[model samples]
Target: MHQTRLRITRILCMIMITALMVPLFSGCASKGNSDADKGQTAQPDTQQQEEKVEEKDPVTLKFPIWSTITEDLFTKLDLVNEYKKDHPNVTIELELLKDTEYENTLKIRNAANELPDIMPLKSAWLVNFKDNILPLDDLEAAKNNLFAADFKVNDQILGVPESQFNEFIWYHKSVFQEYGIEIPKTWEEFVNAAKKIKDGGKYIPIAMGGKDAWPDYPFNEFMPSLVAGDGDYWSAMATKDEPFAKGQPFYDAYVKIKELYDAKVMGPDPLGVGFDQSKLMFGSKQAAMIALGQWFGSDLKSMTDVDINDIGAFLLPVRDSADEPFNTVSMVDTFYTIPKTSKHPDEAKEFLNWFFSNAWYPKYMSEAGLQSTIKDVKIDLGTMFNGAFDVSNLKYVLNKGGNEDYKKIESTIKFDVKKMGQDMMAGKDFDKMMQDMNNSWKNARSKLK
Candidate 1:
């Protein structure tokens, strides 16, 4: 009976040991499962961290524009607001200035070292401000859409042009019809047409805003381009010692303009009015023609009681024969640039890329009524351009590239051709004016050498 009791005790001890061991095994299995779960969850957590890192930090960019950002163009397009949808982090601060005051303001800001991040620059001003502007040749936007005149500065690209403008004579079709003036094909014919309208005494032949110096540019700045039929006329003139002589392109063109003035073709006291007054005179049918570029189309379209269909444009006739091809001055009007002093150059570049892309470029061109500088983008400026758009009938005279020697001489001499046009209208002696210009130009060139 005692032996049987000892065997029972040993069995009981084995059962006790097995019961304690079960809890230890359960604890180990739970730990192994927990580690496996963590291994599976770690990859997704790492991916989430990477996604957070990819998010862009918020940024603001300053965009300085002249006359383009107001209630008319930029506001109508809602470009900035639309851009924000995709790049929610970027905010564009637009600084608008009147076209007349823009260049001076920009110069002031540049001197103060406070240029905006994005600047709309005229092509002629690029060479002057290149030191402060950043080179954009390597940017994808520059590479993709830049034209011959765009971004070129001392072999480095400093900006990209958005659109180009061609100089022309905008006319009222009804006035031309009433006067029996067919579109003039030659300079002489153009004069005759003007004379006919002027002799009528009821309307001004050619409405001129000579008070505003820039309104005279089509005749002063672009006439030589037509007379020479060469894109490099201005630069080539710089090489000549007597570029203002009788047979020279500059002299010949000015002589033609003087003849027009002598004929009393421009309205009485042409210099007495400004651009707005001239536009009104033409819009009211009191004037038959006005010399301007494609930009004037929008203004004409906006006039009260003015029919858009009644407005027409033709390339300024410089050639002698209807059979001969005429040359037109086509130039890059405005360019986009990033100033070296910008705090957000990368963001500026991003904005430019977005601007020139296929998505937004067409819409911008349509609203601005400008021809595209980008390759393969076609813009129809409608009837306002008229014969100006026909490539077969015309050759293009692009703005001449800058020369250091010419730039120096131009600055020192300060020969104002626009002022010369006003003087001609005011009955100044053409011969004396030409003589003075020749003397001044020679002296300036001699100083440069």
Candidate 2:
């Protein structure tokens, strides 16, 4: 008994000694991380002593944004309350604006050299203001390593991409199934399907808001990809100095539009309606389907509460035979830039560096039905994103690189052709209308240097 007691007591003492020494050894190890420590280079993820050595009071930064994003996401205003377990000194000012007013208002501000410290500018607008914005490349931690090679021109890092957004043709699966309709695999099929839906005493097949030039994007810029047969042809059109209205591709596309309109496929009074009206048409089950971004997933579900299994999507089908239908548009989803006039450039950049890298940012975006530009993160596809389609913005653009010429068409031939389309829908002759569009483009292109 005495011998056993001695052995147990010895073991207990050793354990106690080990327990106390562990923390001491850990502290020493952290202090000894230099090369001399050899093999002790790695340390535990505990707070670094350097972080504690010189902590400054948190700096408040104002971030102006246009979206109707909730204040719950303003971490700076929350001051990392959940994370730091206390209020942060940084406060973000949230600025919301209607879509129409956002860009124009920013442009006005830009003219006066007044832009927000952090402003979410549309991608195309970024091209005009690239010089006024600060580049994120200089920050060591902020420099995105994954897509390092992608950073080009003027050292601009732009803003981190938020979500997978694709322009797609979506159909109501249940409605299609009830009508025994197959999803359209070609543009002709799409038009024919619309006619069938209309003949069945259903509302016209597609809804649109033509007043907003943006909604016209699909028909103007994207639909041409179908007629041009591939992206390369579209690119050629961009550099040709001849307007799109001069080409066979442009002619073929307008012909398709005429076919749909002649078939009475578009909702009656499409030009008279607004975006919400069209959205309501699809949401309230008045229209069969529409082409729009995947971000509409949340709104559609909210408006209808339809089962996830019932929502269906497919890329816009090609009109002519081709290797593959160009499935996406390569536009920048959205961007944020530091303006030259910002009062706190360095601070704003610091905040963005932390903001983009924050783990919560990705979750917040996913919850809000957005995709991130940052490459490392993956979506969990929670209740919201599950079965909600998304595609990589990068791949989407590259695939459409062959179709970039389509964009030039909108800037060049769009107004004239759309005017002609309006006349055609009013029962005008196709050839005369085509000739008018070609003449308009010829006149306009000659004005350019």
Candidate 3:
């Protein structure tokens, strides 16, 4: 027992001595402590750096568009708010303007170098603002766009098209069947059918939003292209001195349009109604038909009173004969162009990249009910497109507003075809109007540099 107690005491003293001597060994304890100190201190410094890297400066992008905020494509996509999800520091401010004044507003603002940071221009209007806009040749959005290359000015892509589609005369099929009328295939047939609908007099034969002036695009803006079977007819016309004279496509189209107007079929007061009112007329079944593009399909859906199943579409037949090649407008519209004056161009570009990225573009395309302009990205258009291509010898007319010279002459002469359409609805002498337009165009062309 005495020997065991002494052994236990000796072991205890040795253990205590070893523990006390640990710090004295600088080689082992100091090396271990140094490593431990580094592990403990390095984490916080690394964390602080990570926190710094995660921080981003907030940015706001100004985007102005013609369509009302409710009808705008950006709104449909929830673009402004949606972009803020991943890019919490970014905001897209949308400025809405009337479609009639949209281009003119941009032009007026452009004179002062005050175009919106991001502008959505028509394909025809792109060239007009080429000097004020930035070349987007380097952007992946432009690179992947199928229609972007087609609309390049001076071989430099200035804008990227988001959608490509055909226009149609959206009509009530039930009303057509009720009147014992078939879908018209020629200009004469279409006019005669309108007359027949008028004779019945139960509904307005065709609803027109001539008050807005822009709503007459189907007749005023596009008929000349249809008559010439050329999409770039405006550019082709610039080289000629009297392009709007009789026998010319522009004059001929205007004549046909005037004849339709004379028939008293575009409703009692077509010029008194705006686009929204006209849409309501058609949706409420008070009007048999209304001319619009596929884009109207979404707006049509918004009308809670209308039965979507009853609406059908067909290409407006501008040919005098069904045997002639039927010309259809295949427009690639809404070219997203960034103005040179954008303060946050980098952020704008980043938003565009994110917008056209695979994650967003396809879904947005589907939501808009539009065909994708992105290469290899096919969109399935809605059922309203069925039977729209049942005509023979169809030709596509792609509108490129005009060449450089045409736009210059147009601005100088204040040649507003859409406004002229409104004037036609108000009973202008068609021949005299053409003669005056021809004279103005010739005078403007002579002064071009």
Candidate 4:
């Protein structure tokens, strides 16, 4: 009987052990499966992110410029090869166009919705092209550009200027000394000095390239801005029905310009000579002076025949009195812009940022002999500009673009101040032209959309 009872106890112990072992094995199996499932589910997500990061599409950017290779500093910098070194998948193709046809060509392309990925804009065209351009306000390039914000349209920066320059009356120092004339400080003095040089009959007093019309910018396009002491002169003029009437600022400026043209101090047949001829004449010492912008300094440097050491520059005096504020044209030019129609907007922005980077901007500024428009960059004007800017009442008249309404009025009237300059040189009746402009301006103002 004792042996049989011991066997039953052993059996009961075996049963309890089996039951505990079953549950423990089942728990281990469940935990293993759970971990395997979690890893299997998360692996694809990690791979997907890695794949997304590796995907890049090849891109090509169409960049058109009006400046030829000789005039464009980027060409000398090997811009394409340098850019290609880091971006093998990207290409920049620049097309050269005639400078005279550049604006009209762009207008045509814009109408066809085929504008290039990148282009340069003048301050005056910013308003006309604002709608088609993508505002660069968010770009680092725009943020770094000192003049970009100053030319914003509707609070959006459409483009950023690469350089800043002042208009100058480039002269031959020897000629001035020979004629016993000093750098003019007022409008009267300027005309008188030119008259004196003409009276000597040794050389042309001033080089007037009236044929191209654009070469007349210093007097016709800019004098009114200098008179107003800002770039808002044209926009302000658009507001009135007769902005060119007698006693008006536009009238006052044009009258002064007319007086200069009438002096016949720019040579016997100023209208017949084109800009290239005028520039050559000035370079060869046949002309004493030429009214051009600071960019001309670089052009002057390119002339191998001329003795550039004799060249001097000064701000064009448009003020009536030496006591008045000495207003001068401070132009921010070569406004690089990206079109809204660009195929590769992000890539174009990247290129622009890189263009303005420390790698390229400083070198370009030095090579082009242009003042830096970027923050944290400086350019020395060198000896040619020594004492040229010495004035107690000097004020910079920044060339901010006109407002939309102004552009509309301008387009309607077909008003071209530079062309007006050509007409003045051609001996057109000045008052009659101003009156016609007033009539056209009034008629245009009444038709705005």
Candidate 5:
């Protein structure tokens, strides 16, 4: 009986030991499960952190422009909107202002070192603001342009031209046909054609917008270069003691313009009208011709119902014979620039890459009716200009370089060449005008030296 009791006691001890061991094992298993859950949670946390690092940060760029929103600005706005579709993280803010106000405001902002991210700069103004502009020489878009290589400031390309324009005398094809006038090949022929148009008494030979003053640039600012067959005529004249002498290029060109004025072929009262009025006269077929650049095509297209086929263009024909090399004034009209003070420069540059890409560049130039600055991209400016001059073969005289010394001289003298044109139209003595201009030029040159 005592042996049986001891055996029962040992069995009881075994059961107790087993029950205690079960709880300890259960505790270990619970701790293991907790650690595994934590590992799984940490893995997701680490993945989320990596994803956050890979994501792009949202960026906004500020762009200020000085053109009518409906005009050139709309095309740019459309491009920005299109860019946004591909880059949802990027936004562009456009600041619109009148041209004059924009220039003044930009100048003020530049002084404060707070310029916008992207802006349009005239080639002449680039020299003034190049210190604040970022160099674009490394950009792929800039590298592809035909004219960008020529536009350098201190060996750094600060801007890129989007479009180019050539100066021409735009005439009505129907007008010439109606008057039995062949397209003039020389200045003399052009003058005789003008006289014939005047004698016909049906139309103004040339529409002269004298009241606006700037309308005279074709004759006053550009003709001397055309006559001299030199793109750097004005710059060369800066070194001359008597640039307005009787036999000088400036004097010779002015004499031809004076002859037109004396012949009364421009209009009944050329000095009384402005650019808009002159355009109206030409559009209504009351005038046979107007001298302007390619930009006038858009304006004329909007103002008149005349068919595009009725319009024609020709070089100004300053040379004495048809065989002589004729020079046309060409200009790099608009430049795209990035300011050094930009908050989103990299984003702005990214936008430019998309802007000048093959997908957008051709469309932009075509829609804007501007000559493409991109190599291998040919835009038809219409049959008139296409037939009139072979763009590849024509001698191009670029617009005069901006001279700060001349600017200072102009500001000091307050001599208005446009007003001189108006005076010429009003029968002022050409010789006296020449003498006065020489004296003023001499005075200005002395100050420059």
Candidate 6:
């Protein structure tokens, strides 16, 4: 009986051990499947995130033009790239060419109707090819800016206003101090200063390059302001059926230029000198000053002996007693335009939107001494103007409707000013020159009708 009992007990123990092993194996298999299911569930979210990243990336754009290869351009390009991050669909390709060559090539392309999709157009040419360019009139991006009034052509807007460059008289502070001559505040003061500097026998008062012909434009912009005064003088001259050359302002200005010329205020070979040489003449202390744009600040910074802080600037002095003391002519530095034959007009438009809306531009452009077009974009005036530019009062007046019909008034002025310049250069009979210019403009207006 005892042997039989031992046999049965051993069999029972073996059967119990087999049962435990089976359940343990089953538990292991169940745990493996749970892990596999979790991994399968996470895969879709990871894949979706990658797809979202790709969708948000920007596309590349190719811009064909040549500009100064400076730190400013590089900063602008970098800002463009940052703008693309939020708008991954747009990319920019910079095609830099020599200045003269680029201008020639663009003219050729324009004539052949093979112009690039986007181009930087000069404002002077904007009116000539109004049909070939896209009007930014209805562009939600451009309509709400100060430039809207300036960039309009007849009933259409032609281009985006990038920045304005103002011309000023660049004088060497050291030279002024050494000679003990004050910087002129009025037209008479300026002439007197020039005479005093000439008498000192140190250097000529002005360094001008007549060979280029472009320098003549500044003189044109400057002299008229002195006689006509800045406030709609051109318009008054234009509408009165008065001749540009015959006007008191023109006569006064011509007399001044003749005085400057006869007194030898400018260098002897002014006509033979080029723009760079003129600046160099001033930088090397051969000339006391040069009348040019704000860009001269950058040129002078490159010279070892010349400190930019030592270079002082002043507005062209005006003769009208009641007018503002400082008179200026505004110049558009760069204007943005889209060609009529662009394959990617929508893309270009979208990129401009991104550029203007992005905050990176203000930071980028300001770092390189450029102004931003975006209204909210505030510049540290201390840095940009370097305490030289103080047009705070003018800004206030413009905002307060100082000149409500300023545009129409300014157009007439531009025509007279340009004609006055050409006539003076040609030595035409001053009275006849003014009369012809006025009638010519009157005829131009009649044709516009």
For model 4, name the residue pairs that clash: none
Error of 5 at 447 (Å): 2.7
> Each model's number of backbone clashes?
0, 15, 0, 0, 0, 13
Candidate with best lDDT: 4
User: Using lDDT as the measure, what is the rank order of every candidate, best first?
Assistant: 4, 3, 1, 5, 6, 2
Can you write out model 1's per-residue Cα lDDT over 1-449, one digit (the tens) per residue? 89999999989999999999999999999999999999989989998997775576878898877764334677777878988987888998887788889988999999999999999888767887889998888888788774833347789888888887787788888988988888887889999999999888988999999898778888888888788887667678779788989999988898888888899877878899998898899888888899988777777766786778888888888877768777788878678899999999998999998988887888878766778888888888886666655534677877664466667778888867788888988888889988888888888889867
| Model 6 agreement with the true structure over 190-239: per-residue lDDT tens digits | 77888888888879788876556566556664555445544334434444
Query: Model 5, 1-449: lDDT tens per residue?
Result: 99999999999999999999999999999999999999999999999997775576988887777755324635654866777788877877777777647667889988888888887887767777878999999998899888886768788888888888887888989888988998777789989998998899988989988888778878877888888877667567778767888999989999988877789988977878988799888888789999887777777666655667788988777777767776788878668899988989888888877777777777766655678888888886767675677423357887755456655555567756667788888888889989988898888889887
Candidate 2 vs candidate 5: the TM-score winner is: 5
Worst 10 residues of 3 by lDDT: 67-76
**Model 2 agreement with the true structure over 233-331: per-residue lDDT tens digits:** 454555554434545676767677777667766677777767778877777668887777656665675565356566677666644433344445433
Q: Weakest 10 consecutive residues, lDDT, candidate 2? A: 391-400
Q: What is the alpha-carbon lDDT for the whole of candidate 4?
A: 0.88
Q: What's the distance in Å from true for residue 326, model 1? A: 0.7
Comparing 2 and 3 on lDDT, the stronger one: 3
Taking the tens digit of each residue's C-alpha lDDT, what string does model 4 give over 1-449? 89999999899999999998999999999999999999998999899986765565678899888876334666778888789887777888988889899889999999999999887888888887888999999999999899899888888999989899999999999999998888899999999999999889999999988878899989999888887776788789877899899988888898999999999999888888999999999999999999998888878877887888899999999888999999988889989999999999999999999999997888877777778999989987777888899976999988766788888887877888899999999989988999899889999998873
TM-scores, all models, native as reference = 0.86, 0.70, 0.88, 0.86, 0.81, 0.71
lDDT, each prediction: 0.82, 0.59, 0.87, 0.88, 0.79, 0.62
Sort every candidate by TM-score, greatest first.
3, 1, 4, 5, 6, 2
lDDT for model 3? 0.87
Candidate 2, which segments miss by more than 4 Å at Cα? Answer: 1-62, 69-87, 139-155, 225-238, 246-251, 304-309, 322-326, 380-448
Cα RMSD of predicted structure 1: 5.2
On a 0 to 1 TM-score scale, where does candidate 1 land against the true structure? 0.86
Top model by TM-score, which number?
A: 3
Residue 90 of model 4, lDDT score: 81
Q: Give the lDDT of residue 72 in candidate 2.
A: 37
